[model samples]
Target: MMFLVIAVISTSIISTSLLPNESSHIPFLNDDNFLDWKDQILLTLGCMDLDLALRVDEPPEPTNESFAAKKNAYDKWERSNRLSLMLIKSHISQSIRGSISLSDKVKNYMRAIEKKFVSSDKALASNLMNKLSGMKHNNSKSA
Candidate 1:
């Protein structure tokens, strides 16, 4: 049963990437608006790790559990948690990569979202955003 769930989740992730480029909305997990729900939850967890990193003056750590969807079928998706973590890592990487096009409003909104998962100062999200922006700028300059 557990293996079946992992297989399904894995297949879904691949299919999500391969799905036709239709503009139609599915009322769930569409790519047009923002990251999918799974990505959003993972990003929130990543934000928590980012907060912890700042407080401890260490690098961010992988999530243990909060990213789970808490559904009965999760046993199948359980193994995919590692894959989910990787996806979140990629999202952060892509977010940083795309930060050059991110508007101040978007950045602020994302920072606010990150703040919900963090316990420390609300300012840290801004700080992280600034750092990411700077990094993106530097990368573009070098390219």
Candidate 2:
């Protein structure tokens, strides 16, 4: 699922080629945009017809006695899982990329990404609370 970090030209002041097409305008995952990025990533994957991994659990690996339907399901899932991973990683910010351990499965990868976001959200709320604890509403003073 590892794709070389290559290419440039699109978002922010620096270029952004996160999605397959620059025109897709899917938000890249960054320190501040997990919520937005999450929605976009899901929608984008669905639009690309590659959300099979997200939609269903990985099917059991086909074996010598496996039925044709089971084999097909496994193949479909494997392809979707692989492409989903590539799409997901490509949308992540390079700076935050290293913090996440790579996963062969898209569901697992998404779970890791969500865990990071939840932790960051908690930290932000904690920081805000800490700041609030030190503040007072003196009607005469500016906030």
Candidate 3:
């Protein structure tokens, strides 16, 4: 009995240390990090098994006559959407979050995020193009 107790305590300690910290975080999204943030968010949600809302379209509302599987799918989807939205929103910068339209669906929320970043990306590309076009060989002054 003493040996059994010691083994149990050791196992519990090891498992506890191996588990992810409750406060561990995905980094907050900012104007410059949308691409990396989007990837990390999806990866984190997938690891947590909470990505159903991102994988499938929302189901029609279940009814008294609905099949058990249908009800189950909807329940899973609803839970995924709710949790995903919370996680995504909580990890975003307040300024960015305030600008994004509210979305009850994870897939749509991601789409909205991508749209926000797309403009930034376009502006960056334009700025780089302008700089490249303005460059001269300067052979007259260079060694």
Ranking by lDDT: 3, 2, 1
lDDT tens digits by residue: candidate 2, 1-143: 12323322222323232345565577788999898888888877887678999989888899999999999999999999998899789999898888997899999999999999899999999999999999988789666
In the range 85-132, model 3's lDDT, one tens digit per residue, is: 998998999998989988878899889889888978999999999999
Whichever of 1 and 2 has more TM-score, that candidate is 2
CA lDDT of each prediction against the hidden true structure: 0.41, 0.83, 0.85
Candidate 3 runs further than 4 Å off? 1-25, 135-143
Off by over 4 Å in 2: 1-24, 137-143
Candidate 1's residue-wise lDDT over 1-143, tens digit each? 99999999999786455433332222222223333543554344443332222122222233565344444234433333434334333444343334333322332334443443343334666889889888734344443
- Residue pairs of candidate 3 with colliding backbone atoms: none
Judge candidate 2 against the unseen true structure and give its global Cα lDDT, from 0 to 1.
0.83
**How do the predictions measure up, each by TM-score?**
0.23, 0.78, 0.76
Worst 10 residues of 1 by lDDT: 50-59
